[model samples]
Target: MKLYIKYMVSLRCKMLVKEELTKLGLGYASLNLGMVETMGEITHEKRVQLKNNLLKSGLELLDDKKSILIEKIKNVVVEMIHHTDEIPKINYSGYLSEKLGYDYTYLSNTFSEVKGITIQHYIIKHKIERVKELLLYDELNLTEIAYKLHYSSSAHLSNQFKKVTGLTPSYFKKLKEKRTQNLENL
Candidate 1:
């Protein structure tokens, strides 16, 4: 039996959930962003207990099918973009379809309906966020960040970053530097 959860997005959240489940003596086979596969069927009382426990942590146990599916989609994208060390080389539609075991068209339509944005645009947004993080880290140069994120070139990365953030990558870095300097002086 799988329990779908809402707002269980981060690793910290997942760990907290796992702790709750263990406390209740619920054995789970797997736990992903929005879904938990239990090792065995849960009794009604146990389910209710789990629900309440999740609620206490600001996570909701999902019952609605559409909401569950939407959460799965978001988690998959988030994991792929933010969690993975290497950006996938496969086409995203193909990757999502394969990972979710649904047709690309269905996933796309469902995601668009629920999120009010195309999957491609969502992906671009995440890529920009990752670029910002990398720029802030100050470890990798623009070209390397572009290549690591699998952008065709730095120019393309810069263009998309500017489009999403309304600031050039260099300017963003400079702003961070200025803030740090001000903090140090204080």
Candidate 2:
């Protein structure tokens, strides 16, 4: 049985889900962000228990197809931005279409209808957020961050960053540093 879960975005969330499944004595074939493949069929009573347990830990079991597809889209984007080092070579439309076995047009329309934002815009938002995280880490320079996130150039990254955040990457980095310094001073 394949089950879809909501709010399963982080590695810590995955660990918690795994622990819960183990605690329930359910054997899972695989557990990915927002999805789990069970080795055996789950009884209704057990499913209800699993749902209750996951809810206690801030996760929700999804049953609706649209919600499941939306979660799949989110999981794909989240994995691309937060978990992977290499961006896919293809454009996001093609990537998502191929991954989800739907036409790009259909997926785009569904995403926009459901999310109230274009998928491209959602991707840009995630990319900018990822840039913020990398900036806070202080491990990669602007140029490297640009390349890592598949931005065309450092200037391109800077332009988008400024457009989205009203601050340059350098300014954001400086703000992060200042916050760190103040926290340490306390």
Candidate 3:
């Protein structure tokens, strides 16, 4: 049996799920972001218990096809941006289509209908959040950050950052530094 889970976005979440499954004596064949394959069919009572256990840890079991698909889309993008070292060279629509085995048009329509935002806009939002994370690290320069995130140029990145955040990356970095200094002073 396969199960889809919401908010299972990080490695720590996977660990928590595995721990819960072990405690329940459920054997799982494999686990992936937003998905798990069990070694055997689960009983309704056990499923209920599992659901309640997962809820305590802030995860939800999903049975709806549309919700599962949406969570798969989100997991793919989040894994690429936050967990991986390099962004793929292909365009996002094509990438998503190929990765998810659906027509790009269908995927776009479903994502827009369900998410209330275009898939492109969702990617941009995730990219901006990733940029904010890298900026906070203070490890990579703007040019490097742009390249790592697959932006065409630092100028493009700066423009987009300013558009989304209403502040330049440099200003963001300075604010982080000031906040760190304040924390240290305490």
Candidate 4:
């Protein structure tokens, strides 16, 4: 059985899902961002209980196939940006197509139809969020951040950052000492 979960974007979320399954005496083959896999089918009662528990912790159980597919797309992108040590050198469309086993155009169209935003826009949004995270950590300079996130140059990064955030990266870094906006808000 495979379970699709919402908001399971981070490593802590994976740990939490694993712990919850353990507490429920459920044996999972693996747990990853937005999903858990088990060897056997889940009972209706067990599914309900799992859904309720996940909901309590700000997660959602996706039963619909379309919803699951969308969540899978989100999970792949989020994991690549947030959890992985490095971004792939290949094109994102090709990478996503190979990873998801779907035509890039189909997936992008579905995502845009359901999410009301283009897949590329979503990637940019997530990358910007990652940039914000790196900036807040204060371990890397602007050029390094730009390079890590695959921006062409510091100037390009700054332009996009300002376009999306209404402020320069330097200004954003200074404001990070005060408060940061939620990723969804950006």
Candidate 5:
């Protein structure tokens, strides 16, 4: 049996889900972002228990079709952006459609209706967050970060970063450095 979870976007969330599954004595074959495949079918009582346990950690077990579909879309996007080593070169809507086996229009409309943000905007916001994370890591230069995130150029990445964050990427990195120095001094 496959279970879908909501608000499960990070590795921490995945670990929590795994812990809950083990605690509940449910054998899971595998876990993915916002999803798990159980070794066998889960009893309704255990399902309810798992749902309640997950809720304590701010994760929701999704039984509703619309909620499950939205979670699937979010999981796919999050996996592509934050977890993958290299993002695919194709356009995201087409990629989402292919991955989910749904019409792009349908997915877009559902996401906007539920999230109050267009899917493209959602993608942009997540990309910017990932950029922030990479900047904080101090490992990749801006040009390489742009390339890794599939931006056409560093200039394009800077433009979007500034547009979304109201700060340039260099300034953002500088802010991180200044804050780290302050923390070290303290």
Candidate 6:
């Protein structure tokens, strides 16, 4: 059985899911961001227990097929933006379509319908969040950050960052104070 989860966005989240599965005496074949694949089918009671446990930790086990697909799309975008070392050169629509094996239009429409926001908007929001992280670490300059995030140029990155954050990258970096938001909030 496979389970899709919301707010399972980090390595720590994967670990938590694995731990919970172990506690439930369930063996999982794999636990990736936003999902878990088990070796055997789970009963309704187990599913209910798992859902309640996950909810306690600020995660939700997705049951609807459409919701699962939407979570998959979100996971892909989150992983590509926050976990990968390099960004791809291809357009996001094409890349996502190829990755998910669905038409870009269908994916976009479904994502928007379920998420109440465009996928592109979600990507932009995540990119801005990443930029904030990079700036906080003070590891890269604007130009380097732009390149790392696959922006056309530093100006483009700055513009989007400002638009979403209400502060330019330089100003944000200068603040030098942490202002982290929960992934679920984003």
lDDT of 2: 0.93
TM-score of candidate 1 to 2 decimals: 0.93
**13 in model 2: Cα distance from truth in Å?**
0.9
By how many angstroms RMSD does model 2 differ from the true structure? 1.2
TM-score: which candidate is best?
3
> Per-model C-alpha lDDT, please?
0.91, 0.93, 0.93, 0.88, 0.94, 0.91
**Candidate 4 lDDT trough over 10 residues, lowest sum:** 177-186
Alpha-carbon lDDT of model 4: 0.88
Q: In every candidate, how many clashes are there?
A: 0, 0, 0, 0, 0, 0
Q: How would you encode candidate 1's per-residue C-alpha lDDT over 51-162 as one tens digit per residue?
A: 9999998999988887888888888888888889876789888889988899999988998998899989988998888888989999999999999888899999999999
**How do the residues 16-81 of candidate 2 rate in per-residue lDDT, one tens digit apiece?**
999999999999999999999999999999999999999999999999888888889989999988
Expressed as tens digits, the lDDT of each residue in 50-127 for candidate 4 is: 889888888898988878889989988987788887888898898899899999999999999899998898998999
* Per-residue lDDT value at 108 in model 6: 96
The list of candidate 6 runs beyond 4 A from truth reads 177-186
Q: Supply candidate 5's per-residue lDDT for 126.
A: 95
**Local accuracy of candidate 3 as per-residue lDDT tens digits, 12-114:** 9999999999999999999988889999999999999999999999999998988988998999999889899978899988888899999989888998999
What is the C-alpha lDDT profile of model 6 across 1-186, one tens digit per residue?
Answer: 888999999998998899899999999888899999999999999989999999999999998889988989999999999999877789999999998899999999999998899999999999999999998888899999999999989999999999999999888876664344444356
Q: Each model's TM-score, in the order given?
A: 0.93, 0.95, 0.95, 0.91, 0.95, 0.92
User: Which sections of candidate 2 miss by over 4 Å?
Assistant: none
lDDT of 6 at 24: 96
| Residue 139 lDDT (model 5) | 94
RMSD of each: 1.4, 1.2, 1.1, 4.8, 1.2, 5.3
Order the candidates by lDDT, highest first — what do you get? 5, 2, 3, 6, 1, 4
Q: Tell me the TM-score of model 4.
A: 0.91
